[model samples]
Target: MNGLLRFSRGVDWVNAQVGKYIIWLILASTVVSGVNAVVRKLFNMSSNAFLEVQWYLFAAAFLVAAGYTLLHQEHVKIDVLSSRLSKRGQIWVDIIGFTFFLTPICLAILWYGIPFFLQGWRSGEMSNNAGGLVRWPVYAMIPLGFTLLMLQGWSELIKRIAFLQGRIEDPTAKRAEKSAEEELAESIRRLAEAEADAGKKAD
Candidate 1:
């Protein structure tokens, strides 16, 4: 169990790093979608292919970033009431909420999404719209996104258990700490620049 938890932590770390690459995809997809909308309105011509590509790109961006978002603890939280609790108290709440609510939903989504994508891929499914801009592989994102989300959920479960038992620190609460020496060095740089300017004015 201990080894498995460490392995999960490793996976989460890698997933978080990979998530950064999805930002470019998100930006490109958004630009394409916006351009498509403007072109359709101005020219009164439809480019169904552009529209389809936008959809696929959007899905790719979201699905790819899902694990990273969870790893960074950037997801929405309903911690209004829970924030006031003690460390042990929060652990209890997390365990209960995850076991009863989060785990089931993530598992179900992953289970259903796999078959959904497979069917679409097997049938070579295409857009039903007449003269649609593009025939997108719409089903690809569903399974991929949900699978990443499921893995993240499992990692969260493991981390929560470790935190409650005081075995390992809560992964989310850690911040990058800097040394006092680094701070002093930065202050010295600033002071030197200021003194140089003052001496130049006095000259």
Candidate 2:
């Protein structure tokens, strides 16, 4: 059990690093997109290649970040009722909710997403858009994303079991998961500021 706990922590740590990478991805994608548009307007030139690359980059960032999001418990939860319950009661709710609702959903993603990606890979599928520039494989992200989400689900299950067994307090069950909305809002704010500053310099 201790070994499992350590392993789960290790997963969390890895996911944290992955989360950082996703942030960088968002930053890079945003930069490329802005530059792409500016270059096309100002220079009367643009790379369909660069524009297409931005889409794939954004998609990759989103798919890869799912696990880290889950690890942080940043995914939305209806905790209104649970918040009013006692620690033990909360634990029961978590156990039941996770078991009945979450587990099946996670497993379904793993089951269906695998074959979905496989079909894409087997068919050598490419972007259907004629003007679309990015042609990197789309099939890889599904399996990769689903697998990471599955790992995160397993980690959550482990922690929930610990809570049930009384090895850990329910109140502190998931202290690591950050809110996705909070992070996104911050990112948007930062981007808006950067855009405003750039506009001022141009004037």
Candidate 3:
């Protein structure tokens, strides 16, 4: 169990790092989209490659961040029923869900996705659209993303089991950390207050 806990922490750290870095992909995609739009509208010139690259980046960011999303517990959930359960019950529900539902789904995706990616790579698949990018890189994200998600699922299972065994604190407890938006809002509030204080001193 101790070894498993250490492995879980490692998985969590990997996902956390991946999630943090993947945010830059979003910015890159946004920039590409803006540039593509401008080039299309202003110069009346565009290529499928530009459009497809943007899509690839978007897909990469979305898919690669799955494990990270899970680590943060930010995934959507239907809490209508489960919200009523005790913490232990909720953890049990998660264990069952991860074991029965999430793990199988990820495995199935990987089973199909690997072949899909390999076929594209082996055949040197290109987009049907004019001047489009190669297909394998985008295809590859499916299996890669699912693998990360599956690993995180195992990490979560370990954490939950450890918690149940009195080896750790609540596995589901949210960290009391503010989001970037929240921190920015706080900074703005402080600036406004400081400005108001200066005005008061002047008066």
For each candidate, the alpha-carbon lDDT, in order, equals 0.72, 0.73, 0.91
Error of 1 at 132 (Å): 3.2
Evaluated with lDDT, which candidate comes out highest? Answer: 3
Please, what is the TM-score per model?
0.75, 0.73, 0.87
Candidate 1 Cα outliers beyond 4 Å, as residue runs? 37-44, 133-136, 174-203
lDDT of 2 by residue, 39-89 (tens): 999999876667777877788888888888787666787788779998778
Candidate 3: tens digits of C-alpha lDDT, residues 1-203: 99999999999999987876777677788899999999999999998998999989999989998998898899998799889998888999999999999999999999899999999999999999989999999999999899999999999999999999999998789999765346546766988999999999999
Estimate, for each residue in 6-58, the C-alpha lDDT of model 1 and write its tens digit.
87878787776567456656667878888888888999876677877777788
Structure candidate 3, residue pairs in collision = none
lDDT minimum window of 10 residues, candidate 3? 179-188
lDDT of 1 at 7: 72
Question: Where does candidate 1 clash, by residue pair?
Answer: 48-133, 48-134, 49-133, 49-134
Q: Find the number of clashing residue pairs for candidate 2.
A: 1
Model 1: per-residue Cα lDDT at residue 6: 82
